[model samples]
Target: MLPIKLENIKLNQQYKNREDYFKKMGEQLFSAGLVNEGYSTSIINREEIYPTGLATGEINIAIPHTDYQFSRTTDIFITVLKTPIAFFRMDEPEKTVEVSIIVQILFDNPEKQPDILKELMEIITNQRVLKEMIAAQEPKEVLQHFQINN
Candidate 1:
């Protein structure tokens, strides 16, 4: 199991926009030795080309990631925003989604990405789990929910 550091879990964070959020997140990941310095730029660029936002109907979420080469290890950073921000839908770039939760996935092993992503999408799309995650007030609560479901 990939470890999610409690320090990386942020709740009620405020950001000007999606780019600002990504940049800040990239900096934090780099400082934590989770990703390369260039990971941030790559993430922003990748989001522009391949948006990761998904509308679960219960709550909107975004899973942003970059190439495996940009990562140092496998880890996930979870951010729950106080105010939802606009992000382009993954399947339809023209469509916009208000994302309240951002899951920044960092993987050094390219092979595991597919399986991990599949599992992640399953959890994100599940209305019950999504609701629980959205309602979580603390990082521990969210982590516990994921651990129970994982």
Candidate 2:
């Protein structure tokens, strides 16, 4: 499993729209040398093509990300939104979304992506885990929750 470090995740700045938020967070990751220059565009385009917004009914979430080539390492950038952000639905193209958290994962190897996704899916599907993450105010707490849940 990948390292669950609080340093890898952060509280992103507020944005008027999803595009702005992605750009902002992407630049932060890029500046940290985590992702390539074109990573943001690649992720956004990927979302446009296949979509990553997953709806669990009770709490909607979006897993906006791209392949490993665009990143320098395998890590996850988690951002908790003070308010909801809009994203198009993955399964339902006609519908839009109000995502509370954005999990931007960077997989250094394609082989590890499946396992990471599976663990994340398990975490998201559990109401308790989701609630804990949403209520978490500190990065350490968030990392601890991830470790416990995963």
Candidate 3:
């Protein structure tokens, strides 16, 4: 099963920068025992070297993740920002994309995660799904989309 839970879904949060976003999200995940103590720093460092933002559709998205060493479980934390935040584009690191949705991935298995990653990519690129997720009022509204994928 895909590691998406109600507690992991956050909607309409605001953060000025990626660091602040990861810091707050990492705290929640760490408190849930899903990631290591250094998960935030690890993800932020990874982002600097390799950006996760993508222009999948009109509503751009970012998938920030770290090495399995920082992950305690195979889980995904999702957040829809209250306002769009500029994140460096993955394909073109020099460019920035305004992302409305952030999907933070945490997986303990490198070999097994690719399949789930592929599935998530499919979900990410779907314009209808993206719109539905963004328009969601509650956490369950966002959670349903992943549940359907699972």
Candidate 4:
């Protein structure tokens, strides 16, 4: 299975903007000893240069992340927002997309990035899975959607 647990998944989170999302999520990961200090700021900086937002027709999403040096372990953290937030599109940085879900990826080894991302794309592109994630109230319900790879 993926290196994920109940603590790694947050449901119906409320945040004002992208910065708030990264900072708060970074804090949680830091508290868990999964990332170093300033990881949030690193993510913010990276997002400005390389936005992760993807438009999937029904539900748009963002996969925000930073360099491997900031991470202590490899894991995926997911947050389903109570309200959608606007993030710059990855394909067209000038344009923006309304994203309700945030998938924060952490990996200590740069080599693992592609394999991990490849696994994630399957779930992210599935509208049914995205719908289930937004509706999930419990952590187990959320995890069910991510275990397909393992």
Return whichever of 2 and 3 wins on TM-score.
3
Candidate 4 has a TM-score of 0.95
Top TM-score: which candidate number? 4
C-alpha TM-scores of all predictions = 0.92, 0.90, 0.94, 0.95
Per-residue lDDT for 9-60 in model 3, tens only? 8888999888889888889888988888898899999999999999987999
Q: 23 in model 4: Cα distance from truth in Å?
A: 1.3
Q: RMSD to the native, candidate 4?
A: 1.1
> Which candidate model has the greater TM-score, 3 or 4?
4
**What is residue 40's positional error in candidate 1, in angstroms?**
1.1
Please, what are the lDDT tens digits per residue for candidate 2 over residues 53-136? Answer: 777766677887787899888887777777877888889866888887777788778888888888888777676766777788
> Which residue segments of model 4 deviate by more than 4 Å?
none
* lDDT (C-alpha, whole model) for all candidates: 0.84, 0.78, 0.89, 0.89
Model 1: per-residue lDDT, tens digit, 1-150?
Answer: 545778778888899999999888888778878888799899999999999999878589999989999999988888988889999999899899999899889889899888778767766677776677677888887787567546
**Residue 96 deviation, candidate 1, in Å?**
1.0
Question: What clash count goes with each model?
Answer: 0, 0, 0, 0
Candidate 2: residue pairs that collide: none
Model 4, residue 78: distance off in Å is 0.6
Candidate 3 clash figure, as a count: 0
State how far residue 114 of model 4 sits from its true place (Å).
0.2
lDDT of model 2, residue 124: 70
